[model samples]
Every structure is written in C-alpha cells, then in structure tokens.
Target: MRTVGHLLSRPVAIGTALVLVMLIAGFVGWRLTGGGEYVAPTPSAAPTVRADTVAGRDSLEELVAGVRDGAKPEGKGAAAVATRNADAIGIEGLSARYVAESGNVDEDGSWTADVDMSWRAPGDPTLSEELKVGFDGDGEITGFSADEGTRMPLWLSGPVEVRRTGSTLVVVQASAEQADRYAELAASAVKQVRTVIGWDRPRLVLEVPASGLDSALGAQPSTYSSVAAVTATVDGSSTAGSPLHVWVNQDVIGDLDSPGAQVVITHEAVHAATAAPTNPHRPMWLVEGYADYVALRDTTLPLSKTAGQILAQVREDGPPKHLPGKAEFNTRSEHFGAEYEAAWLACVVLAEAGGQEALVDLYEQTGRGVPLERALRASFGFGVDELTARWRTHLSDSAR
Candidate 1:
C-alpha cells in the first residue's frame, strides 16, 4: 500500500465529538504515558574494513569524512552508526543517509561533528527523516535529533506546501490546490482555538495527509472510521517536547466548509492547544470534556443540535447517574456520542458555575498530576459529587 509518510511515536486516546447532530468519532486529547511498547529494529550486518584509509587516524573521523563525501559506511561500523543514530533521533526501522556537515577532533582524542542526515523506512518511501547529528570524540553519534516543534516525514517535505498561520505551521500533504484549501480551514480553526482559550501564542502543527491516516495515527480504530480528525503526541512522553500532530481523516472531512468538519477541526485543535502528558489518575472525562467544551463554546448552533445524542438518551433513560467515565468514552461503547455529550455538558456546567478561567485552571491543575477532585475544589469551590449533581441538573435543563 502506498501510505503517506508521517511520524507517529505515541499511543492515541480515542473519543468522539458531535457537531450539528453529526457524530464524528476519533477526537483524542492529551498524551498518556505507558502505551504500546516500542519495537526495536533488528541489528544490521557488521561493518566492512576500508583498505583506503591511512594509518594512525580516528576511524570515526574517516567515517565522518566519508559521509561528507556522500559515502555510507558498511558492515559493523554501519550497524553501530545506524543504532546510535536511531537512538539519538528517537525512531527505529530506518535506513539513514548521513552527511557530515562540519566537525573537528579535540586534543583529548575526541571528535565532534555537525552532521545532517535523513532516515527512511522501507515500508514508507515517501516519508524520510532529516535532523542534525552530533558525534563524540570517539566517533560515536551524539545528539542526533529533529526539532520538537514540527517533525514531518519525507512525503511532507518540500512541494508539500507549508503555510504559517499565527503560531501554527500547517503542512498540507496534497496537491497545491487541495493543500491551499486545507490550509485555510486549519488556519481558521487555529485562530478560533486561540481566541476562545485566551492562548495568545500557542504553537501547533497540523497535517492533512493525502492518504495514510492509519499510518499517521499509528493504529486506526474500527470505530473511528468516520472520525474527521485526531490529535496525538509525538513520543508519548509528557516532556518529550515533540510536536502534537493533528491528523485530518480526509475521507470524512473532504468538505472543509461543512459544520461537522469545522467543528472537528476546532475540537482537535483544542486538543493540540491544551495538550500535555496527562496524569493517568485524573479523570479522562474532564480532559476530553474540556476539549469538546472549547470546541463548541460560543457557537450559535442549537443545544438540541449539538447535544442531541445525550438529550435523546435522557428522554429515554433520564439524565445519567454520573458524568461520563473513562470507559464511557471507549470507542466501542454504544454510548460513545452520549458519553461525549455528557462530558461536554459537564464542562459547560463548570464554565457556567465558575467561568472559563476556572475551567482552564482546573484543567491545567489536573494535568499537572493534581487530583481531579482537589483541582475542582480549588478552582470551583466544589467537590466532584457536588459538581456531578450540578452537571446532571444542567443536562436536564439543557435537554428540556
């Protein structure tokens, strides 16, 4: 299969968002630690001896010089270099193209070099990797990595079209015409998220791949087949500093102007904006709910349209006994839409009771490993039970 080239080194959390009565599943929020073990690449064959090298000089420097001259080392040396390079770059399953940009050996017999390189996986030729590399005195590779701000695979390389919208960089992986169209929608979504959340200088990287939504998301859930988009962390580490990737599933979001598409973009943008490695102990409902809340905030869409699923459930079964829990947000759950609606309304209650600032403070606090109930009490002067009661009432009134 010809999949689009993009990098995804993180596990994803799946949720859904309802917009104008349209259920778009696959909205993810916050990075979560300890997911999907990384599979390391098999060791390469040993390096070959180069009879052309002069005696008494560092082999590593010779290797570096060879790379500068557009040569790749072979055998054991090649294997070592490849392994080190992969570790430094934080990716595996790659074949590297190394170029020594600049370097010098120190008096201590140690050498350092600034090398530029690209990594390409056999499975995806379109996406190649690029980063600067640093080598130690012993010729061991050191500090090889790409910037955490925006990491793109080779397919997303030049000719892919990059547009800067505020602090966000929108990379469109499609024809120039289609890319331009996606860029406009993404820019609008970024602006709306910044304005509503009071995030003045938020930085984001949004990608609209021509294909390979599953590759970008690492794994595609069957339930997310209709999802418009999703946001995922680069490395699954809260502190990795890798960029948050907003992946738009073109199949579902082909029409950027549709109400559902706009809402999906904004909702996923909120996840990107507020992204942090989440405290597993914290309630996922709040994390996801807050994203939905920000996405739906201030929209003129009727409550009946936005919260129709929850309202319908309420009409049949009455208000939920409690706010949506983590399990309720499961993609396979029959109540996926209802769960998201309940979570969104829960945040709505929080916003109404204490204002948007309080909701944000609560979100940030909980994200920083603070207990959810404690964060709630601190920000809203109420406990979870009390807030749950209020949210239930809010649901009843909103449904009516």
Candidate 2:
C-alpha cells in the first residue's frame, strides 16, 4: 500500500521542513531453516546449534494476568519483586489500560511477544502499535520495544503522561506536568488549523517524547534525523483513513520559546487538518507552503528572520528561477531550511495575487482530483509558470 510521510525537521528554533516522507519499497525477505528431527551433516565432527526448547505456538494470556484499568505493570523477571516497589521495567508509568487485541507469541517463547496493542486517552481516538512485549512467567510484562531499527512510540516505549484537551490529546514521555503544557500548545494548534480550513477531525493527537530523536515513531532514525515534528498516520502507513497524529521532536522544539513552539505545532496541525494534500500527485510547495502560510500568518516575525535562509540565497544568487521541487526538500540539503522558507514565500505570493480564498480554492480543487494547471488557472487566472514568475518577483521584494 502507498503511504505518505510528512517531515518538519528543524535546527534549534526555525522551520526547515521536508514534509514529504516517501517510504522506499525494496526490502528483501529472508528465512532461516535449521533445528529439525534430523541432525546437520556439515557439523557432524563439530558442535551443532540446536533449540533447547522446541518451538511451539503460545498465547500470552496465560502469562500476563489481572491487568486492571488505569494501572501500571508492577513486577517482572526477577528483580521487580525483589526491590523497593520499583517498576519491573527500567522505565516507569506504563499504562495498563491498553486492550490487547491479540496475545500472540513467537515460536521460541523468549522474552518478546508480538501483540497488537492499542491505547487511547480519554475522549481521544485510539493509536495502535505492533510492539514486542517482554514477559515473564509471573504474570508481568518487563518492557515494550519495536523491531530492530524501527522507532518506538511513546505509549509503548515507557511511562507516558496523557493529557486530553477538547478533541485533542498530548501523550508525552516527559513529566506529567509537561503534558499539560503540550496540551495547551495542542489547543492553540487546533485553533490555528480551524482558522485555516475548519477542523473536522474527530481527534488530534500530539506526541512529545522526551528523547525526541530516539523516539520519532517512524522507520529509520536517519529519516527523521532533523525533523522537529511530523504530522502523519499513527502507524506510518499512507493507507486512506489511517489515524493522524502530530509528533514533535522535543530535542528540536525545546530550543524554541513558547510562541515559537506554538508556531511549530500549528504548522504540523495544518497537516493534520488537511490530511496533507491526501493525493500524492499534488505539488509539495502547495501542500507545505499552505501549512507554513497558516503557521506564519499571525506571527510578528519579519521577512528577514522568517525567510532569512531563502533571503540570503536570493541576495547571493538572486531569487530562485523556479519553485522548490520535491527534491529540494531534502532534510540533508545544504539549504534545507531555506527551501521551506522559499516555498512559504511562494504560497505568500499566491495569497497576494489572488485572495486567501482563491489560494485555498486552488489547493482544495487540486486535492479533489483536479489538475494543478486547471485549478490554478480557474482560481488565479495563471499557470505554474506564471505563479513561479510572480513568486520570484515576490522573493526579491521580500528579500529587500
């Protein structure tokens, strides 16, 4: 299935977003065959590896028992029951309120159990993670971890403080008190989104993990190496109707003050509200530029600071001859932040030429299966080339 990933990774306190996360499609499947009734011939004169315990299908239900509501996993392996009422898992605050969709166990019956676990804060939509739950015979779960190289979500990784506000929620690995602060930011973000297109989503979930880079809730840590926050499906699948969550990289967001943090979240919130141009064919400049438009709209940030990166490039090399392409949005590019600034300016030029309504009309029409040229012509009396020309002129003026 084709899926979309939106990335907004930044430096300390600015917006350098590469909102399109494209999942690569080439992973080879592998299988290891050994351990059978017959012995191997190659190691006849040497030691042959074997399973001490025969592999078998098992259920975790018999292992993990009596999980009450709103509780945390208490005891585990051997040390959990021996110490000062410490959490069996090294981390604390694991919510036991999760509903185990299935208690699946692998053949070896080692520490890990592959389970479809789900949890939701009160009054919010559910988020699901396929976690490898560590378990012991004494009805205790030790820890939850994902497959190798995959990022761990806050809910399953460890203790999470859940704060629900209106139809939105903030689940953080940070302190419970911090969850409240994130909740406020989430509310403001929702309001920003509402101001733009109108918020119709049932719930808006924001995850602000303390270990920002360590827990991005996506594939490949390098993919989100610089992402400050991302607004994408809960499981990272671009499947239609998947749950959307605004995930923040605290390490990047922490550099920003209160207002800047609000702006970052609002930028992500715009993606959540629109489901981010849902159609993959839509140009990213329109998708991300619109988001930046709404985020920077109410800010007092001057063009020099907001578009500082792009402005510097313009002064040195003149305004970009064309709009930022999908390739220019690379997080590792030399002018990464500048690309976002340029795209935002492109949208600003659109808003200037046509009213905000016309700008929005073009986006909505494109999302609804209309071609970009037709939508632009119908809404702004121009095509991509014309828009690019105007955007270049606006870029020059803004730089000055």
Candidate 3:
C-alpha cells in the first residue's frame, strides 16, 4: 500500500525513537520516516535578473527545441555535447527554465546555460530536475548533463557505496563495515519476505544523512525519523513500469543483528515485493497489519514486548471503539505504534480463525479492489462489524 507518488508532509519527532523500536516489526504502508517536528527553513530572496541572462533564457529554450528536434549542435565542448544528448534522451516531461548565475558565453563562440526544470503531471507528485545545456553560441549545442532530481542524492554524488546481497542490491551511505552489515540484513529481509509472501527481491537504498534521505524521498520532510524505512515508487510516477526504491535510515537501523531490525527489514521487503503503480483502496490496517504478521511470523519475540504499548493503552481505556484508520497510522499521530500493534493483532486473529491462506486470500481480494465487507464475508464468513467485535474481544482477553 506504499505508493511512491504520495509525499508525507508531517515531520517525525525525534523523541519517538522508543516507540519506533517496539513498532519497527511492522510496516506503515507508506514512505514514512521518524524525525523531529519539522520547522521549514527560511527562504532566501530571489536575485535580480540581468539583460544578458534574459537573452540566455531564450537561447536555452532554443537549445531545448533543437534537442527535441534531434538537431545536433556544431561544437566540440564536452559539457555542451553532454547537455544536448541529455535533452535528446528526454526530461521525463519536465519544462526547463534558465538560471542567471549558471549561464556563461565562452570566447570561442561556445556557451553553457544552467536551467532548473520541474514536472507535475495530473494526479502525480511534483518534482524538479537540473539541466545544463552547452551550445556553440551560434545556436548549435556543444555538451551537457541533466540531473534527474528524483534520484537518491548519495547515489548521485555522495559517499554511498554499493554491495550486492544475493539477488538484491544494497546501496548505503555509511561506513564500509556498516554497509556490509546492512547488506546482510537486507538479504535476510528478502529471504524472510519470500518465505512468507513469496515476493521477489527489491533494490534497497539506505542513507545516513537527513539531506540525502530527503533528496531520495523527493524532498518531503518527514517527522518519523524513528521509522526504520519506507518503500516508495520511482520518481513519484504511478506508471505500471515505474521502478521502486526502498529507502532506509541507517542511523535508525544500525543494529542489524537485533530482532527489531530484522523485523523492520522484512516488513519493508514485503512492501517492496507487493508494490504496484496504484495500490488497491484496501483498509490501511490490513495493508500494514498483514505486513507485520509476516515480518514477525518466525520471530521469538513475546507479544508483550511487541504489543506492550497497545495492551497498556487498552487496559487503561478498554478496546478501541472502531478499527485504526489511515489517520491513526500517520507519523504525526501519538498512538502510531499502538495502531500498528492493534492492526497486527487483527491479522493474527484472522489467521487464527481461518488460517494463513484465508488471510492471504482476503488480502489479495481486497488488493484487487474488492470491498472490505464483501471480501470479509467471502474470506471469513463475517462482515466488518462482526470482525471488529471479534477482534475487540480477542484484544480484551489478550490484555488480561
């Protein structure tokens, strides 16, 4: 249920690290990370535009047109030539505009123009890409390079290193030793998910710095830095063939040998394996809870350790009046961990009543756009209300 195109706006609170440790065994079904409350940085004032820069903007547009038309620039400048080739390869449907400080006309009738580009198709998230065009100053291109803004910054030009683990690839912006540990964890995660859900391997990109993580996740500020990782679609595109990336925070999951870490990785692997261009409008609880069920299936951790927070809350306030909704799972919610625990227990109850096959069938049917009530009746011989009552009773007994 973690579609790549949706950007979470809430910043994660750093204080939630404890909650994350208990909840890491489950997936949140979105690109969620735990961090402190987000305070937007002050914006700098725009610079004044020069006359020559205005002219350069026009030249940049012409260069874009020439590239679009397959017209090669008559120049020997490497940068200019690279820029033209990049344009020819397409800008992923983004429009480009010139940046004044980035333009330079050389003495050899050659020139370079720096431009900022952005793309926002209907129903898709908006993102930016950087383009540098080189020209002969005579309307011919020389060289150029375009930075696809949606790519991971560390992967693009950071201290990140890559190591392959089985059929999965692990890219990490951490120390060599840490990277190796993460690679192993990632491979184990893939295996665990395959064992439970039978999902294929997925690419894993882990970033240590906040800046790098932000760039990889399309600049969306997250408040859940304690969040172990997030599964996002490539370039926020919902196309069927769009690539998917699993972004993880190494700072949060540095202890790869821990049960929480293993559960976290496996939970995310399930999301990556089941990723689609558009997720079926199934309940977030099932999407997330089912993932947790798989992640913790083989673990030896006690339910008291995993569901302690929720159980304590239940003992104090009794069972929830209704199921946890999408809002309750959000990073900004104080009961985020409890909601995840509750959802996981719900799946456990389903599996207990009808077996794992039934749980999987209900998940698939709901994912195929089947209504919850219908899927519930067909899969479990009960409706939503009945299931909720059963789950509540189960929780009440478990809490005791």
lDDT of each: 0.61, 0.66, 0.66
Worst lDDT 10-window in candidate 3: 1-10
The TM-scores of all predictions, comma-separated, are 0.59, 0.72, 0.64
Worst 10 residues of 1 by lDDT: 1-10
Q: List, residue by residue over 1-400, the lDDT tens digit for candidate 3.
A: 2321222222354336546644764444222665555588999976642334545566656645654455655564442443343343232344567764455455554566666765432223555666565555454434444434444333223334566644566656567786687677778877777776756444543334333255555555564465667776757666654556677776566645678887887777777777632575679899889889989998788879889989999899999988899889887688768998999999998999899989989988888889999999998999889889989998899899
Candidate achieving higher lDDT, 1 or 3 = 3
**Per-residue alpha-carbon lDDT of model 1 for 1-400, expressed as tens digits?**
1211111222231112124123322122112443454578899986543221122224434544543344434443432444433332233333344444443444444433333334432211223434544444444544433443334342312224555555655666567687676666677788788776766667666667665455544454354555667676654345434456677777768855666666787788887777633345458788778878877886788888789999988888889897777788776687767787788888989998999999888888886788888898999999999998998888778777
lDDT of 1: 0.61
Error of 2 at 284 (Å): 0.1
Pairs of colliding residues, candidate 1: 46-75, 46-76, 47-74, 47-75, 47-76, 110-137, 111-137, 126-155, 127-154, 128-154
Better of 2 and 3 by TM-score: 2
C-alpha positional error of residue 231 in candidate 2 after TM-score superposition, expressed in Å: 1.0
Which residue runs does candidate 2 get wrong by more than 4 Å? Answer: 1-130, 135-140, 149-151, 213-216
lDDT of each residue in 1-400, candidate 2, tens digit only: 2221222232432232322121121111112343345555664474433322212112233222212222243554322221211222122222323333234443434344456655443333455556666654333455666775555656445556667656787777787677788889888878877877867754678877776554466565566667788887765678766667788887788888998888788888888777772457568888888889998888897787788999998888999888888998877787888888888988888898898999888878987879999999999998999998888888888778
